[model samples]
Target chain A: MKRIILALAASSILTAGAASAETLKVCAEGAYPPFSKTNEAGDLEGFDIDIANAICDEIGVTCELQATEWDGIIPALLEKKCDAIIASMSITEERKKAIDFSEKYYNTPARFVARSDADFTIDEDGLADMVVGVQRGSVHQDFMEKTFPEVELQLYGTQDEVYLDLQSGRLDAAIQDSIAADDGFLKTDAGDGFAFIGGNQNDPAIHGEGAGIGVRKEDVFLKYALSAAIAALRENGTYKEINDKYFEFDIY
Target chain B: MRFELALQHWEVFASGVWMTLHLTALCLLIGGCIAIPVAFAMLRGGVSGWLATGYVYLFRGTPLLVQLYLVYYGLSQFDFIRETWFWRPPAYLRSACIEDLMGWKVCAADFIPSLRSAWWCALITFSLNSGAYVGEILRGALKNTPKGELEAATALGLTDKQVRRRIHIPSAFRRALPQYGNEVIFMMHGSAIMSVITLQDILGVGRWLRAKYYVPYEGIVASAILYLVITYLLVFAFQLIERRYLRHLNIKAPGAERGWFGRSAV
Candidate 1:
């Protein structure tokens, strides 16, 4: 009877491991809107949330969405706070040096937005005296520093703060992802007087290929699984469905 | 491992230290100026005294972070605050006689372009917050001043102003120094939050490094050590100041060996 109980307990432990094998914890930046944000009811919602869910559904895995600060999200993933990052993080060489990224899920260009009454242009010379704002720890900030070396750049903790400062005339202009500026701010009432001042900045050197699901560098199996799930979502038109909900154009 | 990365980026850490020191010094200097008059007002005990006390309560009652946000972001929300000249000094500074005596123009715009600026906002918020605490500390120190000294100064035919300047204020300041020293160090720690507004102070640069490298431990540890060193230097400087000003109070034991940190043989 003791031998039988020992065998049963060993089998239960293996079964428990198998049961939890398909469970994936995914993290997203709660502040980035139209991609991922916490709604009035305090639940995660938006395009990234839907895409994360769709990827999990395609792979037949249960997923949990964790909200984290954008600045600390990458560290949180590596620390095992979550298994993946689907918070619209662009695939970059600098980031890939630390962690692995799955296939690009979406591609968006950076744009400069300023108050309508502000007659400033977006060129380096035009923005000489202007104080431009960008979200800290973002590709936009990297691009702003490289492209507009002469212009003063202010880094904000959140994209929403850029909009606030722009409204108050504190920030002369702001550089951000085109869609975030459009759907997250410009499409809203707070961004009424503001308009996109410059054309799309799609310099690959700074913006990178596109947004991807980030995973641990050693998690090759998980990375492939996510890539396959993304492909499945694309083939099954789920990607297009989510894209249409948040954006009018195909971001893929 | 992070320490290696932190050492690799020593320049960033150095600049961070400079910015933290800059913020701390500005807060203390400006806040000290605000504290003196408020301390005197509270001691005077009138309607204006209650007003001064209320100012202290309002600022001290709230968190420094909240006060910072209120000045930096909250005040910018108001149209009047944004458009008006509320950021300029009081109308009294415009007095012709006072301006001539100072021999410098008192134009706020000549110094700062706008009060809504992040640097100004941070400075103002920190100064106001530190002023409240410093004012309270000074009040307590002032009250602890011996009444006999003031009576003696009066008996010596000293005016009320003379008595305050000669006997009361200096003694009160000497008493307040140790506590003020701690407050200064607290301000240094508090200045780390200035990075939240994108000030690029030591803590700001530390967070920037952490964000860039994704090695949070190294940058965090480096900043922690930097702050620790800064606090130690401040404490050492204050000890020297105490030794200089409060030398009469220390009854040195004969043949006692001094330790590395100014501690006696005991």
Candidate 2:
């Protein structure tokens, strides 16, 4: 009986694995608004989610979005919790060592957001002894840690918490993607007093090529498929539509 | 198992261990101190006792994670707490306060704790939570003190204050020591939650490593081993303490020899 049950289970697992090929499970950080966020109706929405759907459409696969925490998004993919990660994960050299990435889906520079009334230059010396918040394990964290070591870095689990501390005055400034800070934060009522502090901080060595779809390093075919789908979306005007829905300026 | 990955980041793990140790130690010390007065107040039975009961109920009833979040994030939402309650001391005075304090940067913060800081928030939350548990343990121990001992003290013309100070409290502490040891271990384990608030405790380092490297279980497994070693040490220390302090309570064989250091050679 046990042998039969085990055989049945194995068959079921094999069938599920076969079915998964047609349904691309994509992991996204739902807390990062404008990029990805869960709406009041409990549906995941935003640019990343839309982009993931468009990519899946281009690839002729069903898109299944899985909301995951920012910290464990990559691990979730590596662990097979999802087949791919469509989160706004910057394609850093450090990350490339762990996972494979598609071609650039969208590229945006990191920026610092501070209170509109705050007086400080966006420089290493100017940020001396100031408390700056950034999402933990993010390219922005790497940038701040490497560039402005004088600044006291407070890492939060989510970008929303960074904004929370920033608004509460616990943080003097926060570093994040420019579009995310603008649309998700600065444009909101909660960010009435905050404004972008500096110009685009596009340090490619640290920030990397841009946000890309991450897959397991061994999934070379999936990586190429995703890169091709991204290119198709860009050519077919679906990428522009999604970008327009989220931001006025081109994020691609 | 990616053990090499964890090994390569030994400094991070070491700092994590150091933070966990100090955080647990500080919380235990502060909580133990808070426990004494709370236990006494609960024993006395009045408004203070009522308040103590309420404090214990509130902290013990709710999850530590929620309490921590309330203290760390919830408190920051208030304007008063953000602006004035957590006022930073002047740089000169703060430096003066911690100038000779082993060069630890946090010494000044210890002297004047600010709720705005994650470290202070974590310390406050863990200490209060531990206090409630320890307070209840101490209360039970104090209540169970021998009636004969109290009568004997009274017969010897010992005053109430003297009885409590010299005999009652000391006896209660001795009785509470084993249970208190368990509380210390629990606090050490519970201190892992400090990582959620972004404090680099053992688990924080684990999560950070996992996130940074994308290796699923290596960092967590390393942290688990570290915790296991710390727990083993704690258990061994507690056994030694119990053997020394509670020798009379130990069951002995018919002809057990009294060994050196007060341990029985059974």
Chain A alone, TM-score per model: 0.90, 0.91
Q: What range of 10 consecutive residues in model 1 chain A has the weakest lDDT sum? A: A5-14
User: Which pairs clash inside model 2?
Assistant: none
For model 2, the DockQ equals 0.63
Off by over 4 Å in 2: A1-19, B95-110, B152-157, B253-266
Residue B223 in candidate 1, Cα distance off native in Å: 1.5
lDDT for residue B8 in candidate 1, whole number 0-100: 82
What candidate 1 gets wrong by more than 4 Å, as runs, is A1-22, B2-5, B85-110, B152-159, B253-266
- Can you write out model 1's per-residue Cα lDDT over A1-252, one digit (the tens) per residue? 323433343343235343355667888877778897789999999999999999877766667888887877888887878888999999988798899999999998889998877787778789998899988789988888788888898887778778888887778899888898898888899889888887888888778899999988866666777887788788889999998988888899
Alpha-carbon local distance difference test for all models: 0.81, 0.84
lDDT of 2 by residue, B25-115 (tens): 9999999889889998999989999999999999999999999999878888787765653645456555565454576455453577787
Looking at model 2, residue A98 earns an lDDT score of: 85
Candidate 1 has a TM-score of 0.86
